[model samples]
Target chain A: MLLSVEDFGIEFHDHDSPERVVEGVSFTLDKGEILGIVGESGSGKSMTALAIAGLLPRKKLKKEGRILFEGEDVLTMERHKLRGLQGDEICMIFQEPMTALNPTMKIGLQVEEALRIHHTEMNDAQRKERAIKWLKNVELDDPERVYESYPHQLSGGMRQRVMIAAAMVGNPQLLIADEATTALDVTVQAQIIKLLQKINKESQVAILFISHDLSLIRQISHNVLVMQNGHLVEKGAVDDIFEHPQQEYTRKLISAIPRVEL
Target chain B: MKKWLKKHKNFNFIAGAIITGVLLLTVLIGIFATPYDTTQMNVADKFAKPSFAHWMGCDNYGRDILSRVMEGMGNTFLIAVLTVLIGTVFGVIIGALCGYFGGLLDDILMRINDVLFSFPSILLALVIISLLGTGRLNVTLALGIAFIPSFARIVRSEVKKQCSLDYVKSAALMGAGHMRIIFVHILPNIMPVLLSSVMIGFNNAVLAEAGLSYLGIGVQPPAASLGRMLSEAQSFLFTAPWYAIFPGLVIVLTVLGFALLAEGTTEEE
Candidate 1:
């Protein structure tokens, strides 16, 4: 297994109450596989992803369980080692591309920053050239123009593409995209999904795609994990689960997707 | 220029630029040239009226008031600049640490800041100066300490707001360290707000320095300071009213210039 999350749980502590947000979640992902996690708004899917990245709020939350990436326990890993893993071994792309990018920075510099931090062997000129190449790989029409422009200067779809380029510049083994396309319109969403599919095929990088949209998940995910209110309600091959959902919650969630008949 | 001003609605910008420019220019001019030797005393020509030779007349020590006022502007400007610089460097580091690593560290730092904040800034400066003893450098140190709480408070709140933004979280996830996230990602975003507040801090520091000097604990004797001139002229307020009036006017101009400049920058933002 490339990544194995065993008995993963998360609890948020409040002054009056301690809420268990993610409970006993277990799953495994292999190299070059796409694992889609689908759930509603408060279903703890995002928390699970954040936990994998060690991005949860430190003071307010407690995480339990082991996340072994390449047989190394992520939770117990040294911070310096974990930092090395982040953006290099297991990168992530966030939702809301409009805000995910630093508005004051040029897109090229933002992408170059990722390379500059992780790839110490690459000089400034090499980092800039590689960042531009990544931008082109994401299918940006004028990579140079997009590279020179600020985040606010580009459209939402274009900015998201720049974000993807930044995340992928390091060419990590796994990419955790947390609702990465949810904020876009249907057409742009389809384009980004297709782009992700292309990147996965070409690079053979594993992806853990999280979203609330069932159809979108079905379009790209080979294996699907269904979550409901902090628990993994169902998990299976996408075809098997979509064609015949074993759990009532899974069936209800699949049925909730609006379908059009010819 | 009038048309450009009207187009941009930059009345405050123009006014601020002009007043601050003229005042700073006076300081620069004072460095090389004054109406007469600032410290030279001529008891024969003491209390001379505001004439062409000695523009603002002579002081009690027969020193040219205009020359002394110009020299005092230099001292006042130095104190304000140093105070703001010292306060900002320490303030930004403390605020960033408190805001970024919010928990026990934040609680402790903020409480200390609160204790400092509770006192009137001038009183705090007076206390500090008393302990450090009086001089230009001591006054700068005192005012700088007094200015820290306000700068820290402003920077802390600004950093807090910036930290909650997605860009900061994204940077962290991208393996940027805490220092990198704070300095590279958060600082630039909060700089405009921080800078405007620093300008306001500059205004307050100038006033506080004057207050300390007027209390006879800042910029000791023979070193011309606007506040000291005002204090000396108190006894001759009626006879040598020009002595008090000129320095008082310069102080007002300096404070107003900084206040308006701050307002102008905020509006531009």
Candidate 2:
């Protein structure tokens, strides 16, 4: 398995109550596969991804269970070891690309920073070259100009593309995209999905695509995981879940998708 | 530079630039040239009024007021700069550690900061000065220590704000260590706020140092400071009001310059 998360749970501490935010979430991602996690806003989907990346807020949060990447337990790993795994072997792309990027940083320099941190063997010139190459790979028009521009200078769609380039530049084995396309227009969303697909095909990287839109998940994901109120309601191949959802929650989710008559 | 000036079309900002520029230029000029030896005493010229020969008159000791003011400007500016450097360097390290890690360490550090903050800053500086012994170095150290809590508070809050931002979390997930995240990512973003704080700190430092010196515990005799000059002129106020006027005016100008500069920068954000 490329990545396996077993019995993962998260609890957030409140003044009077300890609320279990994510419970018994488990899944396996194979190389070059796209796994879609579908849920509404409070479904604990994002928290699960944060736990895998080890980016959960330390205070008032308690995590349980194991996340294994390449058969190594992520929860028990040393902080330094976990850090080494992040951005090198595993990377993430966030939902709001406009705010996800550092506003003051140039697009090229940001991409170069990813390479510089992970691929220390590459010299400055080589890093810059690689960053520009990644920007081109994302199919941005006038890559050089875009590279020179700051995050605020770019349009929403352009910034999202730059974010993708930065995330993928390290060639991570698995990329967790947490609602990566929710902020974009439908046309731009399609382009980003296509770009992500191309990167997955070309690099043989696994993707954990999280989104609330069932139709978008159905179109892009090979395997689907349904979550509701912090519980994993269902998990199976995309066609099986869409055609014959066993769980009532999963059936309700599938039926909730907006459709158009031909 | 002209374009930047035009973009920031605030009267206080322009006035601050002019005043602060003049004060800094006086320090630079004092380094290379002063009209008379600041410490040289001339009994015949004592308490002379402002003129070409003895501009801004002479002090009770007959030391040229203009030269002494210039020398005091240099001393005051150095102390303020040094105090700010010490405060900012130590404050940023403490604040970054507390804000970035933010658990038991934050609580402990902030409690310490709170204790420091509760005491009136001048009293804290006075206590430190008494223990460390009164001198230029001791006053600077005392003032620097006194300045730390405010800087730490500002930096801690700013760092906390930056930490909540998506970019910082993204940087951490990108394998950047805590030190790298705080310094490389968050520091630059919080700088505009920090810069304004530093300007305010400079203003406060100048005032505090003057207060310390006026109390007879700052820079010793022969080394001119605005506060020391004011102290020496207090007895001669009725006999020679000009003795206290020059240094007093300069002190007011310096404080006003930095205050306006701080206000301007804060508004820019």
Candidate 3:
């Protein structure tokens, strides 16, 4: 297994009574597997992603389970070790492409930054080449033009592609895409999903895809985990969950997606 | 360039730019060349009217008013620049730390900041001057320290707002350390805000330096300063009104230049 969570739970120690965000959420992701986490608003799906990546705030937070990446507990690991895993081993792409980029930095430099942070031995020229290569890999038509442009200069879909390029350039073992395509329109959304699928097949990097859309999840993910109110409601292969949902919550969620009937 | 300026649609900016540009020329010219030596006193020519020979007339000491005004402006401008430098460096550091990691560190730092901020800047500066002793360096140091809370407050607010943005989270996920995220990610985004604040700070610094000198605790004599010229001209106001009038006019113009420039630049936000 590339990643594993054993009885993993998260609670915010914000008030007199600690409020639990995620509880008893246990799952495993194998190498090159695409695991889709589906949920509604206030569901703990995004929180679980943050916990696995160690991106949660360091203050007034409580964790009550083991998150083992390569058999080493992520919760118990040193900060430096965790950082080493973050960008180099496991990368994340967020939802808002417009705000996810540094507005002042050129797209090329920002993409190059991923490689620059992990590989100290690589020269600027080498980093630049890799960045452009990844940008092209994401199928941006004019990699050179997009590379030189600022974040604000590009459209939302283009910026999302640049973001993906930056995430992929680092050659991470796991890519956690948290609502990565939700901001785009349907056409752009389909294009991004296609790009993510292609990257997964070529690179064999495990993907933890978090999204609220069941249809989008079904399109790309191999396996699925349904969440409701900070708890994992169900977990199975995509076909099994759609055709034979065992839990009422899972059935309700699957049925919520409107279908066209002849 | 023309297109960008027209997009701003701020007349205050253009007027401020023209005045500031002219003043900058005068200050630069003052460094290398002035109409007459600032210290060249002509008791016979004292209280002379504004004319081709003495465009701003002469003081009671018979010193050329125009030369003194030029030299004094340079001194005042330099002090303001140095004060702002000190404020920006220290204030940005404090603000970034408070902003990026805001649990206990924010509470502690901001409370101290509030205490410092509560004092009227001029009063705080005066207290500092009383302890540090009177000189250009000392006065600049005092004003700069006084200015820190304001810069820190603005930067802190900006950073706090930015930290909530997804880009900061993205940077963290990229294994960027605190320094990288604060300086590279957040600071660059807040430059427009910081730049305008710096401009306003410059305006305040110029006036504060003049205020200090007027009270006889800043920019010592034998060295020309706008404040010192005004103070000296007060006794001879009736004898040579131009002495006080010219220096006072320069001070107002200097302050207004920055105020207008700040308004212009602030509109970009």
Name the candidate that leads on DockQ: 3
Residue pairs in candidate 3 whose N, alpha carbon or C atoms collide under 3 angstroms = B42-B62
Give one digit per residue, the lDDT tens place, for model 1 in B136-156: 999899899988888888889
Q: Where does model 2 exceed 4 Å of error?
A: A13-17, A57-62, B1-7
List clash counts for every candidate, in order: 0, 0, 1
Model 1, C-alpha of B136: deviation from truth (Å): 0.8
- Candidate 3 residues A1-262, lDDT tens each? 9999999889999899999989999999999999999999889999889988989877799998999998998888899888888888888999999899989899998898767777989998899899989999999998999989999899999999999999889899999999999999999999999999999999999999999999999999999999999999999999999999999999998899999999
DockQ of each: 0.74, 0.77, 0.80
- In angstroms, the error of model 3 at B167 is 0.6
| TM-score on B-chain, cand. 3 | 0.95
> After superposition, which runs of candidate 3 have C-alpha atoms over 4 Å from their true positions?
B1-10
DockQ of candidate 1 relative to the true structure: 0.74
- Please report, in order, the local distance difference test score of every candidate based on alpha carbons: 0.90, 0.90, 0.91
lDDT of 2 at B110: 98
Candidate 2 docking class = medium
What is the Å distance of residue B258 in model 3 from its true position?
Answer: 1.8
- The Cα error of candidate 3 at residue B83, in Å, is 0.7
lDDT per residue for candidate 2 within B215-256, as digits (tens), equals 999988889999999999999999999888989999999999
Error of model 1, residue A75, in angstroms: 1.2
